[model samples]
Target chain A: MTRFALTLEFDGAPYMGLQRQPHGPSIQQHVEEAVHAITGEQVTLHAAGRTDAGVHALAMRAHVDIEKAIDPFRLMEALNAKLRPEPIAVLGCAIVPDDWHARFSCLGRSYIYRITNRRAPLTLERGKAWQVSAPLDAAAMHHAAQHLVGHHDFTTFRSVHCQAASAVKTLDRLDVVRDGDGIDIHAAARSFLHHQVRSMVGCLVLVGRGKWSGEDLKAALEAKDREALGFNAPPDGLYFAGAVYP
Target chain B: MTRFALTLEFDGAPYMGLQRQPHGPSIQQHVEEAVHAITGEQVTLHAAGRTDAGVHALAMRAHVDIEKAIDPFRLMEALNAKLRPEPIAVLGCAIVPDDWHARFSCLGRSYIYRITNRRAPLTLERGKAWQVSAPLDAAAMHHAAQHLVGHHDFTTFRSVHCQAASAVKTLDRLDVVRDGDGIDIHAAARSFLHHQVRSMVGCLVLVGRGKWSGEDLKAALEAKDREALGFNAPPDGLYFAGAVYP
Candidate 1:
């Protein structure tokens, strides 16, 4: 059996989440069904991250083991052809070692949250970005984001439904920058608890709106309690950007 | 009567065109109906340009005469509320002079064509961008684009059904720039014959792919015949970016 690594890009507006659910469809279910149609094998697909519903992904890594004697290029083309009508694409596919795991072997992950700061309602950017009518101070938000960029208990930012064993995780970076009419918040870490990025971004937006201060963010981290969370941004603007490995 | 200028942004994937057509819906029809619903008066909406079917607009300038006394903000808010679920928005609204015309008074117009050069199919940008699987040399396209700048009888570029009295028009600018994985072509002119920008971009893509040379583009312009055109790009990638006025 040969293991293949696949790079994926998708608009997550229609799915319940990346993983399959009994209630609704998912990226994994569609991919697996496509694979079954092509190879006639019921196989399991593993992904680096299981993104929430309405959360987009620029490049999400995954892997699957196949016994068929098929080339990577043909496999990618066939999968893309079958996945048609669905907002998912296999950007790349390649052979990988059997030991390489899509999730367990990942070194780090990164995400970007998009906020369109404009009074006008979003037409072209509908469902793709979060719109805030009030003026936002991106510089101030950047200052507040720095407080969360280190090893700490992020319980205040994590969701109550998070299945992670511990809240302590090292955040590699957190950056905020304004581009034209929108603000982009980039976050990187080895791993994240559920809703961590959105929660942090929510509070940062408050700082940008002059509703919270940098000190408030630092204090929230110290509290390490879910009740200390200020705000939780929606999943519409969040994108699972990338995952890295050696 | 008061002439009100409305700045519109829309995703043109669903509409037949910006102007009303006999067979399908249009941006004009939607706006006119919405206006009538709010003011209880039959009105006509005039635009800076009549974009083709499937052509998007970022900030399309239009004008409508209304007898009802209403503030720009309130009118804008009401229109937005009535146009709900549709991918259209009123970015701005203000009162204009009685003599001002959306088309005749416009001194210049600008458009942008987007090409996503990649092998993978688009996900988030499915209908919004033209997917070109081959590699494109944006610099080569830009160099070929310069040959179309300046005054010329662009009969080769104009649509066969064009109703303009004269085929002669001055093109102020044509620029090609690559942004990440996609390429953008920006065109500006005092006026344009039907399908001018799309025709030019289609030939530029050929030049970018090494199928045509700069000399070929010049020859096509000199031929001054509709049959001399090499290609005509689809309206999916085209956008009515802006309109300039005195």
Candidate 2:
């Protein structure tokens, strides 16, 4: 069997999530059905990260094994053709070593959250970004985000149902910058717990709006209690930017 | 009566065109309806440019005369609230002079055409950009676009149904630039004929695709005949960027 790595881009408005579920459609189900139609082989597809509902991806990485002898370009073209009408595009495809894994062998992951800071309703950027009617201080948010870097117990930031065994993880980078009328929050880590990025972003927004100061944010982080969290951002603004491997 | 100038932003996918059409909905009709709903006055709306169907707008300029004693901010807020579920927004509103006109008083007009030059189909940018699968040489396109600049007979670049009195008009700027995987063509002039921008862009794409050369483009412009036109680009990629008034 040849393992083919695929780089995917999709609009998450239609799918339930990245992983397949019995409730509704997903990115996995669409891609798997396209592969089965092309190769007539029932195979499972594994992704570097399982994104939540209404979450987009710019370059989500995935690997699928197929016994059929097909060219990488042709496989990609066929899969893209079959995934039509749906907002999914295979940006690239290549053959990988047998031991190369998409999930376990990943060295790093990155995500970007978009927030449109304006009172005017979004027209061109609707559904693609989170619209915050209130003004945001990007510099202050950046200053507060630095405190969340490094190893710490992120219990206050993670979801109550998160399946990760440990509450402690090292955050390599967390940056907040203003782009045009919007703000971008970039997060990078080896791995992340469920809702960690959104939870942190929600609190950072409160700080930016002057509802909470940097000291208050630090105190909340030290509390390590879910009830101490300020807010939980919606999944609309988050994007799985890309995955890195060594 | 107070004449209010409004800066509008809209996704043009839902309307037939910017003008009040006899058969279908339009941007002008929607804005007029919103004004009537807010002020109880059936006012006529005039725009700086009447964009074609499926064309978007970033900062389209329009004017409406209202007899109601309402502030600019309140009018903008009310119009925005009524324009919801229609993908249209009033970005800004200001009271202009009684003689100020949205169409005739405009000194300069600018437009941007976005072309996604890539092999894969667009996902997030679907219906928002024109996707050209073939490779495009932006430098070559830019070089050829210079031939269409300056004063000349644009009959070959306008629709046959164009109603302008004279075919002679001066083009101040015509620049082609590459932005990531997309190419942007910016055109500015005191005014333009019907289908002028789309016609110019279609011929430029041919030059980019190597089907025509810079010399061929110059010859086409000199022909001054509508039959000399190569093609007319789709309305999907066109945007009424903005207008300037003296």
Candidate 3:
């Protein structure tokens, strides 16, 4: 048996999410079906992170084991060929050790939320970014984002349905930057509870729009209660940028 | 009557072009319809450039005369509200002098063509860019493009169906830049013949791929015949980025 690590890029508009679901299609199902058609063996695929519906991925890492002998290039090309008409691409494939698990072995994960801070309704970037008509103070957003950085109980930022046992997690970085007319919020951590990034971004936007101050954001974090959550941003602007493994 | 100079943005996938057409929908038609629905008076929209099908625009300049007494902000807001579900936006609207025109009075126009230089098929940027599997030498393309700059009778680059009265036009700038996995071709000029930018880009790609040398590009330009044209790029990557006026 050979284990392969695949780097993926997908537009999450049409799929329910990254994980398999009975109600609708997912990235995993399409990839699994493509693998089955190629290897003639039903093999399960494991991913580092499970993104929500309408969330995009730039370099998602996944792993699969197959008994059928195939080269990495051939597997990648064949899988990409079969996954056509769907907004998914196999960016790279590499053979890996059998013990390397995609999810369990991941050391860090990162996400970026894009906001088009402009008055005009987005045309080319309609679904790709969150549109905020009010002019944003990115420097203020950046300053406020610092309040959420470092170790803390992020209960106020997590989803109510999150299954994680503990809300305590170490946030390595939270940065807000302005690129042209767009504001990008980048978040990094060893692991995150469900909807953490989106929830944090929602609050930061309020701060950028002068609704909340930096101290207010820190107070919300210290509250550690879900009721204190200002808002949960939509999944359209969230992107699983990449993962790191030791 | 108030003459409004509107800064427009649109995704050109669903339209025949920027101008009104008898068969299919156009950007002008949508703007006109939106105005008619709001004011109950038919009006004409004049654009700085008549872009082709599938050619997007970032900040297209246009002018419209409305007989209805209305404010610029309200007119813009109402037009945007009425142009719903379509990938179009009125970025800005301002009252302009009656002598000002969208097309005839324009001092300069700028365009950008995007190419994804990679083997992987585009997922997030499927319709937003042209995908070229082969590697491109941007420096070589830039060197070759320099030969086509300045004043010249660009008959070779003009389309057979081009309606411009004269072939002599000055190309102010043609820059080729590489941004990570993408290549951007920026073109600026006072005016251009139909399909001029695409034709030049097609030949520059040949040079980048080592199919043609810098001398060959110059020779093609000097030939001044449409038969000498190497190719015409697709409209997918073309964008009417903006316009300049004095």
Please tell me which predicted candidate would have the highest TM-score against the true structure.
Answer: 3
Candidate 1 lDDT at B204 equals: 92
Deviation in Å, model 3, residue B146 alpha carbon = 0.6
**Pairs with backbone N, CA or C atoms under 3 Å apart (clashes), candidate 1:** none
Candidate 3 Cα misplacement greater than 4 A, ranges = none
lDDT for predicted candidate 2 compared with the true structure: 0.93
RMSD of each: 1.4, 1.2, 1.0
Question: All candidates' lDDT scores?
Answer: 0.93, 0.93, 0.94
Error of 2 at A210 (Å): 1.0
**In candidate 3, how many Å is residue B155 off?**
1.4
Off by over 4 Å in 1: none
Sort the predicted structures by lDDT, highest score first.
Answer: 3, 2, 1
What are the models' TM-scores?
A: 0.97, 0.98, 0.98
Q: What digit string (tens of lDDT, one per residue) describes model 2 on residues A1-246?
A: 999999999999888999998999999999999999999999888999989999999999999999999999999999989999899999899999989999999999999999999878888888788989889999999999999999999999999889999999999999999987889999999998899999999999999999999888999999999999999889889999999988
lDDT of 2 by residue, B71-124 (tens): 999999999999987899998999999999999999999999999998888888
Candidate 1's error at B220, in angstroms?
1.6
lDDT of 1: 0.93
Candidates 1 and 2 compared: the better one by TM-score is 2
